[model samples]
Target: MPLKQFISGVAEFSANEVLQLDSEYQTYLQPLSGKSLALTLLPIEQTIQLQFTDSRIDILLPNNRADDVGSEIGSEVDSDCHLTIQLSALSQLRDTNQLTTLIKQDKLDIKGDLSVAQHLSALVNGLDLDLTEILTNKIGDVPAHSIMGTASAVVNYVKYVKQHFDITLGEALIEEKQLVASPLALANFSDEVTDTRYWCDRLAARLAILEKKQLAGDK
Candidate 1:
């Protein structure tokens, strides 16, 4: 739950920072101001809600801060977008912007409208936030930028390593250990099933024709 807590805190902070920015920046998030998004993380079995208000984005963790906002766990409140994904794959989705590709690869599953996710992406990308200026009062501009850069690099490297590790482990299991079927094997099996069904359907149709002709001859 520490990661969930950190994510919530970051959302809150980002919302506050966006509010303090100029009106032009607010326009980027206007489309999402009244919508809600839910992210269901795999393995952890947690759903985090991002409730968008006109002022800020409230990140609600079930049985946690959600109670503060009068939200219930598994509530009837509909989300504009609900994404079910691996917790580890979140950064890849963000950094790569390959939502459709990920879905095709079975790396992500989405419910509800995709336009909502697009709007959310727009909100993130359109905001050219300069955090250095915000922190310059407390620390010098050079130090602020340096810290932000180092943090960004560290995050990217960690994500890169995690992604590669998952891929390597999957390969080892499928190719080396024979513990799992590869994607190509799955596709081939699907094709074989389809072909078998086609032949069965054709045979059934021919049998029906023969039965009808025999009845006609008997009559």
Candidate 2:
């Protein structure tokens, strides 16, 4: 099948599903006041760009495979550096929802800003697309590497922070690792991981708040 046809089919499949997903996302972010998240689904292997402005978020959905979807959120008065998530291997993960999940989980290599990647990761996970079921029905047996590799990457990132920055951000970061690795692990752990969805929501909220505060302080 042609890429366009495939993408169209995927979009059709996700259209109704995305509404529920977005609602779940909003519910997950209920604690965050005055913040909005925009999600854009595009053709395979397209770049997902993000910009920060004042008061509103601008999300440009990719109209064609070659086109890029640029998204930005913040205030118009003062903005932070624009972040971009380029999907170089989008086509590879396009046909298989499992592969997409693997990429989001960091099982596949993501070459870009890690912080932005993490934020995108959280955003993708928050989507209520029922990817798990899709993967199970289409592609039986989830790859163990998908979760393990992501867990390892998070672990390494945490270690790097501790060794270089010497700033303690607490267990939330670690809990993120666990949640991505095995969301069920959250139930086992008494820490912040207990609320896997909340962890991602809080991370995005705190990051936005911190970014806004830093911009303010700079002014």
Candidate 3:
């Protein structure tokens, strides 16, 4: 299937899953009733709008032209708030209550109603779905436990490898290749420049004073 279709399917499935808990956790979403929010994923330029009711949410892909995946956020959005985020940061959003932290880390950007965004974050963090229990019911308990264990291990391993790779690449650029300056080196160089400028200004002032004294003597 096409990328857009796949994204739409995922969004729909996610919305349905969220709504399944609405009956029990509708209080979290009550503040967002009759409101809408737009989330735009960067680099892919896909925008998904979430229309919230008291107990349901409808996810939609607005201005989904595949050819314009590089275009800006669609102007057709009528959401109470809009959130723009990097695609890579979606995983970090699992900690939905840390909206301020994510913004500080340059992982998310928000516009429009901040209260709506906060309420949305509260709703996401409030979800208490027992995925392990669901899996145990669908399959056997042993299989469910094994699958969850394997999934968790794989995720941890991937995170470790990614961290290692980033550190290695940064070291190569800063130390091995000398393409990027080390922080200490940069700071020292900045201090040297500042000192040179200060001395130059002082020397200029002294020369002016000397010239004035020489003129006074000649008079």
TM-score of each: 0.51, 0.23, 0.58
lDDT of each: 0.79, 0.46, 0.83
Model 2 vs. true fold: TM:
0.23
Q: How far is candidate 3 from the true structure (C-alpha RMSD, Å)?
A: 6.3
Best by TM-score: 3
Lowest-lDDT window of 10 residues in candidate 3?
64-73
Off by over 4 Å in 3: 1-9, 18-23, 38-48, 61-118, 211-219
Model 1 bad stretches (over 4 Å) = 1-11, 18-23, 63-77, 95-97, 131-219
Tens digit of per-residue lDDT, candidate 3, span 16-80 = 67557434668887899999999889878878888888877777888745476565566667788
Sequence-dependent TM-score of model 3: 0.58
Please give, for residues 15-128, the per-residue lDDT of candidate 2 as tens digits. Answer: 435534444654433332233233222323333233322222233333332233443221121212222223444444333445456557654543333344344445455666
Q: Largest lDDT belongs to which candidate?
A: 3
Clashing residue pairs in candidate 1 (N, C-alpha, C atoms within 3 angstroms):
none
Order the candidates by TM-score, highest first.
Answer: 3, 1, 2
